[model samples]
Target: MDTEEKSNQLELETALNNQTLYWQANLKLLVKLLVVWFAVSFGCGIILVDWLDQFTIAGFKLGFWFAQQGAIYVFVALIFVYARQMKILDRQFDVGDDDSNQEPQS
Candidate 1:
């Protein structure tokens, strides 16, 4: 009932809301990245291989390329994508390390 108590409660609620938003953003990013990985690894490499085989790239069948190398390439690229996204998220959430940005005191 005291003003001080109410202010503390509001601050706590705001912090909780921010934390929740950060988590939701993180989960969404994870799910999107996973979907991309799955699509590249499973869909292109296996499910659509036959259909994709109809195309060729520099004497290599598209499906064979997807199965043997394309998926791995995509996976590596996805790793970079995830890292970049997480870095952005970390900054947005104010969770990123700040020591590197601080000036040393004399």
Candidate 2:
């Protein structure tokens, strides 16, 4: 192969590797957040409800709070967390909302 062809092939391989790494990082973050949501919503709300009920929060049982309100609140918080984390990840991967890389429109 010519030098230019070899150079293009190397660039392609590098881009593919970077894409794979970015995807793996994204999935890792997703799995971690999901596990936290599952533990709060299912583990605290249902599986350990009886145990958690022994505790109180603002005149409500902890388990009931998880089932009724806490889980929803946590999920919302997780949404923001995901957004912020993804923003950081995007910056890290040089992938999103980067106006500096764009040409000015006429």
Give the top-scoring candidate (lDDT).
Answer: 2
lDDT string for model 1 (1-106, tens) is 6999999999778877877998999899989999999898799999999999999998888988999999999899988998899888777867665675432322
Summarize candidate 2's per-residue lDDT along 32-89 as a digit string, tens digits.
Answer: 9999999999999999999999999999999999999999999999999999998888
Model number with the top TM-score:
2
Give candidate 2 misplaced runs (Cα > 4 Å): 102-106
Backbone clashes in model 2, listed as residue pairs: none
TM-score of each: 0.85, 0.88
